[model samples]
Target: MTTLRLGFARGGLEIKQFLRSRESVVFTLFFPLLLLVIFGSVFDAEIAPGVSFTQYFAAGIIAAGLLTTGFQSLAIQIPMEREKGILKRLRGTPMPRTAYFIGKVIMVLAIGAAETVVLVATAAAFYDLPVPSTAAKWVTFGWVSLLGISACTLCGIAFSSLARTGRGAPAIVTPVALVLQFISGVFFQYTSIPEWMRTIASLFPLKWITQGMRSVFLPDSFAAQEVGGGWQLGYVAIALGAWVIIGLALCVFTFRWTDRG
Candidate 1:
């Protein structure tokens, strides 16, 4: 109980600090909106028979925002904290290690929520994205968002173990993330990609995340555009669940207390 409270306080501080940072505000908040506006403007027509390209891409943009906020942000921030001796100093203190990580997870979840609202609003306003209009659609969005935030946050923590210094964090993280995004159909039409590429992408969470969002926003007829001709909500849940399990194991066994190595 005491340790949880410590984490609660610590998480609040982290969130406030992150919110105040100008760079974070731009990247976390505005970057997705910009992308949505730019690409959505260029591709204005329906990609499929009834679904506009803007609608098709908007879901991907929202997922991109959530991914950037949780996975990419933490992948960089953790190493920077280590470089600054923040993690090392915290480690030397009596603070519970779990409290520190819990603090990070709290901060990421808060950011993820805020990013979702902002991205969804922008997409609806600019791209005419079919908002979740029914109870089932909203329910799907709710679960997908919850699982997505969890998966990305855990992946971020586990991947942070790879960073040895703050200076090179983005170089290491961004390329891998971008590659995954491209392959996962976040920045392009999913079916347009080759079958082999789609096969490779199936192993990752972002593809399933995009599919989950499409399920909620696109019409039921849009399912024809999907890989299996349906939403595949079960696969989304299972894939993200697998990632959460993998992340938990990696964080426990391989997480670096400090970026000394």
Candidate 2:
């Protein structure tokens, strides 16, 4: 209980620092909106059969928003903290090393929840999508989004340990995230992509996340393809679970509290 409380305190401070940055605000709030505007306007229904460009793309944008808030943010922040000797200074205190990481996870979870609300509200207003019509769908959305956030946040921490300095962090994280977003159908419909790209995207955690969110908000009849027997529920479980496992293993092996490492 004490540990958790302290973690929350640390996380609150982190959130405040991040929120104060205008660049962080843009990345957290407007970057996804920019993607939404570009893709929503440019690709009309004529581009895809049976799919509304705005509605179908909303899920992916929400997924992207959450991923950026948690994964990309942590990936950049951690190494920057290390480069600035923040982590090293913290280590000199009595604070348990894991507390620092735990605080980061809590901060990311809070940010993810806020981002979800923003994206959902925006989708409802701009895309005319129904809010989750059933309690079951809402529950599914909560579970899947939370799980996805957990997996990605841990993966970010694991990867950040590989970055050498503050400058290297964004260079490494941004391009990778951009590539994944491109291939994961956040910017384009999956059906429009070639078979090889579709298959590759299917393996990415972002794809499962976007598809799972759609399953919660969109009608079942609206699903473009039956993945994992139905709406790819099985695939979501596998992809997220695999990433969580791999992320934990890597963090265990590589995570460092001190910049000197």
Candidate 3:
């Protein structure tokens, strides 16, 4: 109970810091909106029969917003903190180290939730997006959002160990994330992407997350466009679960408090 309280307080501070940081705000809030509006309006026509491009595209943008917030942002922030001795200083503080990480996870949760709202609201207002209507659909959205954010956040923490300097952080993380975004069909409908490319994407969390979102937002008839012509809910759960485990293990193994080396 005490630890939970401490983590909440620490997380509150992190939220304030996020609000103050222009880069953080823009990426978390603006970038996803930009992508949605630009791509959605331009590709508003149906590339897939019976599925409006906007409807097909909105859900994936929500996942992208969450991924960019938790993965890309943390990848940059963690390495910069280490390089600036922020992590070292925090270690010397009286607070539990776990609280710092909890704080980061909370930051991801807050931003990811906000991003979801923004994407859904924008899509509905501007693009006439179809929302999750059933109780089951909402339930699916809940679990998908939770698991996706957690996996991305943990992966970000693990990948943070890769950057040796503050300047190197973006160079290291952005390309990997951008490549995944391209392959994972964040900016395009997965069905239109090549089968081999989809296979490459299926190996990662982003693809599953986007698929899960599609399962919730798209109509039952829309399943034909999917690789298996179904939601593949079991596969989504398993793939994301595996990534969560792998990410947690990697973070435990590779975490560094300082860049003294």
Candidate 4:
């Protein structure tokens, strides 16, 4: 209980420090919004009868934003901190390692919620995207967000152990993130992608996360357009839940307090 309390306090400091950085603010917070605007403008067509391309794209962007906050950000930030001896210093403190990770999870959840709101609002205001109106839909949104954020954040912490230096972190993380986005249908319609690509994407959390977001925001009929011609909510839940478990295991095994080879 005390560790959790201290972790929350640490999270507060993390949020404050994050807000102070202009580059982080723009890249982490606004980059997804920029992608939304550019894609929303360029692809001004209906994905379905009443749904514009922007509406469909919005959910994917929100999923991607969660990835950026939880996965890409932590993957890069932790290694940089480790290289700077910040994590090493923290390791010697009375704080438990779990508390440190709890702090990171809090930061990612807060930022991810804010990012979701901004993306949904922008889509509604400019693209006529409708918010989810049903209680069940909101419930779906909540669980998906929780599981997706946790999976990505823990995986990021685990992946950070692979980076040998601050300078190498982006090189290791960015390409993987970019490839996931492209292949997981963040930047394109999932059904439009090749079947083999979809099969590969099914192995990852982003594909399931994006599909779950679509289930929440899109019409029920839209599920017919998915790879299996259904929303596959059961599969979505299973995939993300599995990743959460896998990520936790990886974090336990691979997390490092220093950038040691």
Candidate 5:
């Protein structure tokens, strides 16, 4: 109980710090809204002759927010903390070191969940999209959203070890994330994309997350063309488990408590 409280307090502090950053808010919240505006407008006219652009855009934006909050933010911030001696300072406390990580996980999950809700609500209200009508689909959305955040958080921590400075962190994380988004079928339709690109997207978690989100909201006809046979639960499990193992291994091997180089 004490350790959990410690973890929650630590997580709360980090969340407060993160919320104070204008750049962070811009990317985390406004960027999705920006995409929602531009792409949502472009695809407004009965995309695929019956499909709702609002529904499709909602899923893509949610996936994008997850990546931004879970993966990109961690990749940028962890190395900064290391360089600033925050990790080193924390190590001297009586608190369990895992508590810090646990806090971060909790914080990011909350942020991701909030982003999902905001995007969904916005879509439903102004964009004319309805929430998932079936209980099964809502359940699927919940699982997929959780899995998406988990996978990205793990991958982010793993990648953070590679960055040496905060300055280079955004440069390193953003371009790769953008490339993944492009190929991930978030900004583009999967059917219109070439077969080679589809194969590439299938190899990444971002694609799976977007596909999973679409499965929850879109019809079966739309879902079938996505990779992994329409959000197969097995694939989400496999991808998440693999990333978790890799992240844990990297954290054990290279994650440092001190800024000392």
Candidate 6:
């Protein structure tokens, strides 16, 4: 109970510090909005009879935004903090390690949710992207967001240990993220991509995350455009659930308080 309280307090501080940085606020919160506006404007064609390209792309952007916040941000932030001895000092404090991680998860959830709201609003306002209209759809959106965020955050924490310095963090993390975004249908349609590329992307969480978002945002008939020719919500849940487990294991084994670990 005390730990949870401390974790919440820590999370408040994290949010404050994050908001204080103009560059981080712009990049982490609004980068997806920028991408959405650019791509949503550039591509005006319809993917289906009633579904505009903007509608389809909006779902992908939301999924990608979650990835950026939960994965890429932490991947870079943790390593930089470690290099600065911030994490090392935290380790020396009375706060339990679990509490520290809880704080990070809270911060990621807050930022990711805010990012999602911003992207969804922008898409709806300018691009005519529809918000989930049913309770069932909202429920699907909730679980997918939770699971995706968990998988990405844990993976980011684990991956951060690989960087020996702050400068090295982005070098290692950004390419992997960019590649996944491209292959996972964030920048293109999944069905339009080659079978081999789709097969490769299936092994990752982002593809499933994007698909889940599509399921919530797109019409039922649009499911036919997916690789499975359906939303495959069961498979999406399984894939993301598996990654949550895998990422948790990796974080336990790989996370280090300092560079010397």
* Per-prediction CA RMSD (Å): 1.2, 1.9, 1.2, 1.1, 2.0, 0.9
lDDT tens readout by residue for model 1, 158-178:
888798888889999999788
Weakest ten-residue segment in model 3 by summed lDDT = 47-56
Better of 2 and 4 by TM-score: 4
User: Least lDDT summed over 10 consecutive residues: which range in candidate 4?
Assistant: 252-261
Q: Which pairs clash inside model 5? A: none
Q: Which ten residues in a row have the lowest lDDT in candidate 2?
A: 42-51
Which lDDT tens digits does candidate 2 get at residues 39-58?
76776573334447677788
Q: Give the candidate number with the greatest lDDT.
A: 6
Backbone-clash count (model 5): 0
Please give the ranking of all candidate structures by lDDT, highest first, separated by commas. 6, 4, 3, 1, 2, 5
Q: Please give the RMSD of candidate 4 to the true structure.
A: 1.1
Off by over 4 Å in 1: none
Candidate 5 residue-wise lDDT, 160-183, digit = tens: 877777678888998989988887
Error of 4 at 117 (Å): 0.9
Candidate with more favorable, higher lDDT: 4 or 5: 4
User: lDDT per residue, candidate 3, 7-54, as tens digits?
Assistant: 888889999999998977997799889988988888888756667878
Give the lDDT of residue 35 in candidate 1: 82
Which one wins on TM-score? 6
**TM of each candidate vs. truth:** 0.97, 0.93, 0.96, 0.97, 0.91, 0.98
